[model samples]
Target: MTYTEAAEYILNIPKFTTKNKPEHTRAFLSFLGEPQERVKVLHAAGTNGKGSVCAYLHAMLLAQGKTAGLFTSPHLVKINERIVINRDQISDDAFLDIFEFVLGKVKEMEAEGLPHPTFFEFLFGMAVTAFASAGVEYAVLETGLGGRLDATNSVQHPLVTAITSIGLDHTAILGDTLAAIAFEKAGIIKPGVPVFYADTTEESNRVIEQRAAELGTPCKKIGKDAYEILGIRDKHIAFSCVNAYYGNTTWSLNNIGIYQPGNAVLALEIMRFVFGEEGRPDLWREALHELKWEGRMEEVLKDVYVDGAHNVSAVEGFLRSLPEKEANIILFSAVNDKDYEEMIACLCRNVDTDFYIITRIEDKRAAHTKELQHIFETYTDKPVFVRESLEEAIDFALEHQHGRKIYCLGSLYLAGMMKGYCNSGEQ
Candidate 1:
């Protein structure tokens, strides 16, 4: 089958079957020869910044001259973006080869009356299998959802685990309160494996500490105090860690997001654990200075950027990272499952935007453009425009910029569509 057809088959699996139990995932991995066991895996989980943390780890591993694989979620552009080795996405031929093999396994399972893997599970299996075949020395795995029962959690052993900032997301499945959500994220902690986490809140930190204690694992918390932002200049944000080993040296990231320093520091601490005295902070510094994570305040066009900040907490971070009191134009869209109203309210209250444009993402769960427009109209006196088509919304935002920057945000799907449009040279 063609690569497109193979991807379609995996995407359609979600429509027919629900997520299987953890045992099912473990058993499937076993059937696939437990490829995860062949590599030193670094598992990362949290509400936000987990993907960034994984990217940082992968970059650090590469800087150290180790072959690394990165498995992330909600690819901003293509399915190949979800799996990368040595900074390159898996080739279409490689993807189809693995897809056909996994498809055969799924058929065998069906013949034995076993449930087929869900969309995420099938992809996770493919990532590990590909990593194993390539003989990568390390693999960075990001949890798809809440960590405890996530398909990625089937990897019973990992060299280390890290948890990024925790917040109220996936409230129905994970939990509503911060502590409840923290418990789910902390489930990634395994006995004797050291875990590092971003110290987001007192309540959440307490839950993670308790979980680590119960598992008899060493847990280190990296708080905001661990690093201080120096400044943002020339499309880069510079920060200095409090760790004296760095000797007050400032580290800069290619992207200007304010929250990235925290994510970078979390990855730095994990690398310290893994590499000890042999860890080359200089190499890591250079790697981060050159790294650019797509869809996180990524500038797709001149002064036109897209961010994947669909949840309330991520929106808060996005607001914090924006230039204070600068008038901007926001092109926003979100899925129905998100708290888009609260996200809108937060953006309207905090940001000095010239106006707001609302559009719908290309997803079955996308919120209607009219609904988003009404919500924006309620929150701010700023002119709210509705465009049923994302392309029209982009055009309107650009024409109405009036020298103000344009930020398209609210959903990864929206970011993906915008990036695809920009890359297609249609913008």
Candidate 2:
């Protein structure tokens, strides 16, 4: 099948609540000779920072001169971003080949009255196949949803499982409380496997600790107390970590947000567990110095910044990363499922935003521009403007920026769209 046709087939499939069976993923792997079995996995799951943690781990592994694969979700620009090996996205031709192979197998299964794998499952299968074929030393996986039934969780035993800060995200499927969501995220902890998690609330820590105890798994956590940020100067954050395993090590990150110290500590702890003596301080320095993860406090243009802070906790992180000076204009959009009201409240609490430009992104789940404006207006006296088109909202923000910063946030979809808009040559 052509790559475009293959993308249409996978992209059109329902993302959640489909005929995707957890066992069917395993069965499909069995049919394909279980590529996952050949690769050592570092599985990560949580409400936020999962992607950032995975990105850090993948970069560090590569810096350590290891062949690594990364499989993340909800692609910003293209579907190929979800799969990578040796720091390169799977080529379109390779994606087509893998998709056609999986589609052929899926057809065979359908002919035998077997259910089809969901879109995420298919892409995950492709990642496993590609990683194994390429002989990657490690594959860092970010869970697509709640970890208990997430397709990536189908890996029987990852080398090390890490859970980022747990919060009230995916409430409908995961649960409404922090403990319940922690329970789902802690599902990645296999028996006797060492698990590392970012420090969160007391309730969340309790839930994760209880799960680890039941499985006899060793659990380590990185919290604010574990790391101290020296300063953030010119988009670079200098920090000192006082973790038990890694000791008191000072490091600096290039253009990373204020909240990244915790994620960095988590990645370092996981690396300590996985690579041990092989973890070189030199490689760690190089990785941190050049590490980059898009859609998180990213300065895409000269003074315009974009962040994917869709939920309450993530918005708080995004806010912490911003300059104390207020933004001249803020362009915001988010999915309907997010707590944008709280997110906007956090933004207002942190930044003296002058104007709020509410926009709707290209997603069926996007919150309407009018609804966002209503919520944002209730939080701040900033004049709220509505533009259903993302490009127009960006234009409005840029045109009125007046030498002050223009910040776009609230959703990764919105951030991705704005990143494309700000970087377009025509702009």
Best by lDDT: 1
What does candidate 2's lDDT look like per residue over 1-427, in tens digits? 6888888888887743375667888887876678998988999999999999999999999988999999998888889999999879999999998887777887787788777788888899889998998999889999999898888988997999999998777788889999999999999899999999988999999999999999999998777787788998768898887755455666888765788888888998888877787778667878887877888888888788888877788877877777774677888889989877788888776788778888889999998888888888787887999988977877777788778888888899987787667667657
- Error of model 1, residue 168, in angstroms: 0.9
Model 2 scores worst on lDDT over the 10 consecutive residues at 13-22
- Which segments of model 2 are wrong by more than 4 Å? 15-19, 243-249
Off by over 4 Å in 1: none
Estimate TM-scores for all models: 0.99, 0.96
Clashing pairs in 2: none
- Per residue, candidate 1 scores C-alpha lDDT tens digits across 1-427 of 8999988898788889987999999988877889999999999999999999999999999999899999999897789999998889999999999999888888787888889999999999999999999999999999999999999999989999999999988898999999999999998899999999999999999999999999899999999899999999999999999997777678999887889999999999999889988988999999999999999999999999888998999999898889884548899999998888999999999999888888888999999888898899898999998998988999898887777899989999999999899999997
Task: Give per-candidate clash totals.
Answer: 0, 0
lDDT, model 2: 0.85
